[model samples]
Target chain A: MNAIGLVAFALVGSAKAIRAEFDLFGVTVVGLVTAFAGGATRDVLVGRVPLALQNVGEVALGLLGVCLAVVLYAWLEAPDDRPITLYADAIGLAAFATAGAIVAIEIGLPAFGVVAIATINAVGGGAFADLLLDRSPFILFEDFYASCAVLGGSAYWLFTALAADATLAAAACATVTVGTRVLALSRGWTVPTAQRLEAVTGE
Target chain B: MNAIGLVAFALVGSAKAIRAEFDLFGVTVVGLVTAFAGGATRDVLVGRVPLALQNVGEVALGLLGVCLAVVLYAWLEAPDDRPITLYADAIGLAAFATAGAIVAIEIGLPAFGVVAIATINAVGGGAFADLLLDRSPFILFEDFYASCAVLGGSAYWLFTALAADATLAAAACATVTVGTRVLALSRGWTVPTAQRLEAVTGE
Candidate 1:
């Protein structure tokens, strides 16, 4: 599951790097950070050395994903459009949200704790990647991005707290996140910008 | 020492936010993240719940720093210039570097681990703030920033490993980091950018 998420995250990171026209080294750096930073953040908060640092396999998988992204970039004539990027991001978000929430739950964190960890873990990598590239983090404004993670994480915590089956809870978490994201994309839903509020207040 | 670093970091973050024309909430968010993110990152990687989350005093200190920054901004007619910002940054870097190195050493991390953790803890907050504001992270290109952290961390580790007194080692670490940064500023030292390599390699 983590390996799959790594690939998805790498692709998202790589695409962003390519859009920024970063060199190969830059691409790899961005991809690796995006793929591992979330889990690393989670592990660090839990008082464990990040698996990304301890496990050779995780690092290798991240590298493989970056290399594959580079290869794909070389092969493709055109850059990816918005839809493809959003979909990939959604998938990665759901994966990490479920994974992070479960970890939080296992540690007996409260509902808020579970949601916070899950949301941060799901989106933190992309945020790090964007920040490194000198862009405003996507989580700050990207449509339904961190929101999905929050909702999914909360749902997961709710289900688990209510004595739901583990697999069932996990599935529900993933489904809600992905489904909300897809709907938000199709419906053009967005978290309102502060600019709108300022205009309304006329301040 | 950590509290001082937190306050200093909040000032830096708040200054950046003011420069970016962020509203009050944005300023507070940026300030809090800047003050806490470094230590939080360190704690998380070490598999411990972050002190920022666990300790009420720490949170209160962080808030106080942000409020102070906001008040300062309101009182001041002009935003800070580059030199003032750099000087404040240098102080923060020195403090966090020494503290982080001590923690890493006490935890029995290897020399490399000590350096990694120390350097990251020293500069991670500023990096996060820069990224959030859509500016290049200072450590990536700022004169002798992370380099100072590396040197300081290594110096601390070496001193401790060689049976030097703890206070003396910490003083040496801070002095080296701040002294180097000050010298770098006075001497107009800058990190050599990769763009220079592009010119040489014609890539």
Candidate 2:
């Protein structure tokens, strides 16, 4: 699960860097950051050394994703906005969110902490990458992306509270997160902004 | 030291949010994040709950800074570029960097980790605030800001290596960091970028 998340996020991040016309070094840095940052942040919040630093295999997997992205971009000329990357990103998000939720629960965090950490673990890398690209984080204002993690985290908490099996709870969490993200992607779903709310109210 | 750093960073962050035309809630969020994020990050790296969350006084100090910023902005109409704010920011940077270095040493981190965590603790908040404001972090591509922390951290390690007293080492770290920052601000020193280097080399 960790490997999948690392590779997918690295690919997604490298694609963004490529689209932004960054140099090769910049692309690799951004990809590595995207792949490791979310999990690193989760580990930090839980008071542990980031797993990326401890495990050489994790870095290798992230680098593999970066290489794949560079090759794919070279072949396709522009793969960032394509469906393949989007689907990979969705899967990565679910994997990370579920992983974070399990960790938070294992560490005996409160429900709010669990959900918050899960969401952060899911979207933190994309947010960091967006910052590197000199833009507002899409999770903050523009996308329906993070909401899926929030909902999935809530579901995980609910299942745990109801004494569900750990594996069952994990599966439900990932399924809900990925399902919602894919549906949102296909249906153009977006969270309403303050401006949209004001317009709706005619105020 | 934490109190001073928290208040100063909060004021600086709130001022930035106001200049960006964020609403009151946005300003508050930015202010709190800028004040707390660095310290929180430092604590997390060293394996502890953030002091801000653990202590009510810390939150109050940060809020005081936010309120002060809002009031000052309303009165002066444009105080973001004022010298007072710059000096306060420098102090905050030094205080946070010294604090982080001390923690890293206490935790027996290597020299690299000490320097890295110190720099992150000093500038993490500003970087985060910049992200929320939809801009690339100033630390990444501009300013002589983070380098001051790096130098300070190195100095701290050197002092400790020479078997200096912990208090003296911390004082030296803070002094070096703030001294360099103030000098740089007055002299208009900036770290050169790739473009500048290329231009200089006539490449």
Candidate 3:
């Protein structure tokens, strides 16, 4: 399988893990949504009817992801099951962000629009997915995760302007993005907050 | 508020009622997605950015819907305590489908594209919304629901061409849509099934 395919499989697995509380039907639904949610967002932002529904591979793969998730959850049976949800969500965001920006820039979007499209593509599905599942993944409390995605997308757009070193820049962008996410996870560094001294907090 | 605002708020409340198990954030997400999912979809399909973010009112109203839903759910808990999810999902779908058709046809889409776009605008969000929340909504299981949305949208499109009366046709479309949905719910009717009976019977 290609990189995208591998990542998609991981997504299905993670979806199952996340939806362990749900029934089988519910698990299937979660798997499909998590697997295709980002892709659907990317396609919509780029004015391309969703490609996930256009092919059987994606659906089959998503089901497979559900199965894997079920098995993995059964085996793990603990909340500390590594970074299944986090990694899958992050990778899905990055892949879709790349796809969104490329499609936007390809269709002659301006710089700012490209950035906005990329950001939406990256976070839109995950946020919606989390909300539906009664959680708020990255946006609710994850610091700087969304920022990394936007930065990566912007970097990808910038690389388009390069004449010879475009691929190199794209690689750099991916590394920077994935690295930031991993660092945030490993170092326990969150997006900074501004919940400073409140007016209600008296001396 | 305008008619659209009223419809939007009602749809948002309905969405929350349908997705009853969701949290406050989840309710807001579902409400906003249900309320704006149609028009947002129309804009994206026609290569226009979603207007939800452009107009601050839409967001405020959507949040208001969430608040309304929170209050309604609380009140219902104290009184009727009936499962109104099916009803709310239906209302949301009906409104989105009709409005989506209008948006698509107005954008000069051909008959088929308009029908497809309108139907997606109507059913996509609701279906996926339910799927995300692990709810096997009747529309997915009971059947005849999405098909009616398509039919209503198509009727509206056809009527617009023959009568040149936008309001009349839109009303007709909405009527057919709601009627079909309501009858289906009341009578427990469904569309055709193509499953393998032999396999089920072990023939």
Candidate 4:
């Protein structure tokens, strides 16, 4: 399951690199960073060594995903690539958020920590990639992206606190995150932003 | 010394936030993240729990640093603020790089790891802050900044390998990083880019 998440994250990163017109080396590096940074960040916050550094298999799989993405980029053009990247990104986000929430729970972090860590873990990789490419982070200006992770993580926390089975809780988290994001993407739903208030002149 | 470094890092983050016109809350948040992220990253990579998460005092001091930055920004305009921020940033960069290099050495990392970790540790926080503010990362386009850290870390690694005293190695690392960066800033030194590549069409 972790492997699946990692591969999906790498694909998302590769897509972003492709969009940014990065070279092959940049694409590969971005893919690796995106797949690995989330869990590594969570591990650091919770006072543990990151598993990404220890698990060579995960890294290898992520690199393989990047290679696959390169092939995809060569074979497909824009409109053809968007859906696949979107779906993969959504899945990766859900999986990582759920996994991060579980870790936060295991570490006995507070509610704030659980949600914060999970959301950050889910988004950190993409954010890092965007930063490297000198683009605004998707999370800061995208449709229902980070909010989905927060909702999912919160749901997972709630379920676990209520003595729900671990698998069930995990499922709930992944479902909420992926479902919401997919719906938003398909329907073009977006969060509301602040509007400027009109100035009133003395009439 | 570590405390000073942390404070300086937080101030650097705060200065960035001020430049970006972030609200107070945003300033505080960025400041804390900048101050602590480098060590946290190094700890995670080296298979230890991050000290920032374990120590409340560190968090408090970081917040205090943010407060100090807020006051500085409030009192000082642009030209008045630049020098202080630059000097503090240089100090923070040097201190973090040296500390990260020492950790890599203690953990028996390869020479590459020492330099890579040190450079990453020195720049990660400010890079993150810039990313959050939708600015290009300074390290990607700056003069002699990351280069100084690489030099410093390499010097530290060499000194350690030669069985020099730990304190002396740290001093060497700090001196090299700070001195190089300070000179570069004072001299208006900049890294060479690919501008000439555009003119080489015929050649």
Candidate 5:
């Protein structure tokens, strides 16, 4: 939970629109939302009655994410904030993607469903929070966010097939997700624009 | 869905504030938010992946609720819109409460957990939307909104204990909830307030 909290704090920090001039409160709120909201959302969707309700540790993790965001932000006060936010976001994405997949698998979802659920669970809260905050989702704008998640899940899927093991799948998937995200951002590599943009926004 | 939509529509039509100046788009957006946001929120909280992704019907119901609000506003054009908003709030509370409890029960949560989830699922979204929209949640101020949901889940719990005996529990619970809400409003009965007021305006 502590590890995940740190990752989630970074993810939410990255997703915020730095131009929005958010205070510490707003930053903490975003972190809380992105980290807890996804798992909480998963619980509601699965009708598990919110694991957080039963698990004090999960609740503590959420609070931890908010605290970390504030502390981390203060520590990284600089001319360039992007580097700090990017690394944080990457950590969050990897942790959540792996966590989501594992949860799904444990709950007896099929592999496809597990992968899909994991991908969404990892990204959904941050995406929704960013939307609510009136910021374009980092995934939809610049970063190859979804692609990396997909790749991570695919790696997990492949590793699990090879070994018929959950631990290896999760570790491999998370590592792939983080490394791929870093590479994508550093190289400015992207999935080709299959979506028709000129046709989307008419003048 | 149609019945709920009709109720939602009538609630909107009955609001004088909305009819006075707000456009069709604004009214519809409010209605949609009022009707669907609760259920969407419930789904998000429960980790109900399929519910979120596959329940296209819920979206349709939301659209219906929005349309109902639009038509109702255009036709009734009522005065003192307070009652209308109250009714809409009630429906949102009831519908979301029902969904939350049912999902909790379906997922095999214990009675205590179901009740808690139902209560939160019922009110959380409205509270959030209100917070986002910069308004107070109705549950905190008027009507037996949260209480009704808790009672309703209790009924469901009791019913299950009675071995699915289609007895008075379910109906009684529903009646208690709805009746308490309407009665509280009709009589202007409020939670006791002794020294509730603060020194500052809006305090």
Candidate 6:
């Protein structure tokens, strides 16, 4: 799950940097940061050393993802909004969210903390990448991306609260997150914006 | 030190949000985030619960700063880049850097980690606020602000390595950070950008 999340997020982040016309170095840095930042943050919150700093294999996986992204970009000519990349991104989000929920649960955090950390683990890297690219985080105002993680996290907490086995809870969390994200993508579902709310109320 | 840093950073963040024409709620959120984000991140990195989450007094101090910013904004026509605000910002940066260094040292982090955390603690909030405002972090490419934190953290580490008392080291760190920042401001100092370096080297 960690390997899949790292590679997928790195690919997603590298695609964004490529689209932004960043140099190769910038693209690679963005990719690595996207892959590692979320997990590193999770570890810090749990009072552990960052996995990335301690494990070279994880860094290698992220670099492999960056290389794949570069290859895909060259082949596809425009891969940023493509279906393949989007699917990979969804998979990554689910994987990270599940992983985060497990960690938070193990650490005996409350339900809110579990869900919050899960969402943070799933989307923090992308948010950081967006900031580096000189833009507001898309998760803040765009589509239904982060909500999927939140839902997945909540599901994990619920399953655990109901005394489900750890593996089952983890699987449920991942499935719920990926399913919701894919469904949202296909159905064009979006969270309402503040501007939209104001318009509706005529205020 | 914590109180001073929180209030100053909150005021600075609120002033920026006001300049960006955000609503009052947005301004308040930005202020609170700017004041607490860095310290919270540092705490997380050190494997402790966030100070903001643990203490209501800290939150209140940040809110006070936000209120102060709102009042100044209403009175001064523009408060974003005023001398008073700039000085306050420098002082906040120094205080946060010192605080972070102390935490990292207490946690037995190496010199590099100490300096890195100090810089992060000093600038993380501003970077986050910039992200919300849809801009790249100024520390990544702008003036020499974060560098002062780096220098101060290094000074702290060096003093400790030389067997100086912890109190003396901390005082030196804050003094160095603030002094350098004020000097940089007065001299209109800026970090050399990649473009500038490229031009100089005729790359």
| lDDT by residue (tens digit), candidate 1, B87-194 | 776888888898789889888999999999889889888787877988778779766778989999999989988999999899989999899989988897777778
Q: List the residue pairs that clash in candidate 1.
A: A44-B44, A44-B45, A45-B44, A47-B47, A47-B48, A48-B47
lDDT of 1 by residue, A85-141 (tens): 557667878999999998888877776568768887898898889877877775665
Question: Clashing pairs in model 4?
Answer: none
Tell me how candidate 3 scores on lDDT.
0.61
Best first by DockQ, ranked: 1, 2, 4, 6, 5, 3
DockQ (Cα-based) for each candidate: 0.19, 0.16, 0.09, 0.14, 0.10, 0.13
Question: How high a TM-score does candidate 6 get?
Answer: 0.62
| Backbone clashes under 3 angstroms, per model | 6, 0, 2, 0, 18, 0
For model 6, the DockQ equals 0.13
lDDT by residue for model 6 (A71-156), tens: 77755766657887788789989999998999999999999999999998999998878878897789998799999999999999
Q: Which stretches of candidate 5 lie over 4 Å from their true place?
A: A1-7, A10-30, A41-47, A67-82, A107-111, A134-136, A195-203, B1-203
Q: Which stretches of candidate 2 lie over 4 Å from their true place?
A: B1-32, B51-127, B136-203
TM-score of chain A taken by itself, candidate 1: 0.87
True contacts kept of each: 0.31, 0.24, 0.07, 0.22, 0.13, 0.21
Task: Name the candidate, 1 or 2, with the larger DockQ value.
Answer: 1
lDDT, candidate 6, B21-81, per-residue tens: 9999999999998998888777777678888887989899999999998998878976757
TM-score of each: 0.61, 0.62, 0.53, 0.59, 0.55, 0.62
Off by over 4 Å in 4: A1-101, A108-116, A122-134, A138-203, B21-29, B68-73, B78-80, B192-203
Q: lDDT for every model?
A: 0.78, 0.83, 0.61, 0.78, 0.59, 0.85
Q: After superposition, how far is residue B133 of candidate 1 from its true place, in Å?
A: 2.7
Give per-residue CA lDDT, model 4, range B1-203, as digits (tens): 56777887888787676566554545665787788877777877777766765566877778878877766654466422477667877888899999899899888898999999998888877777777878777789866788889999999999989999999999999999999999989998777677755556536
State the interface C-alpha RMSD of candidate 2. Answer: 5.2
Colliding residue pairs in candidate 3: A12-A65, A143-A191
**Candidate 2 vs 5: which has more DockQ:** 2
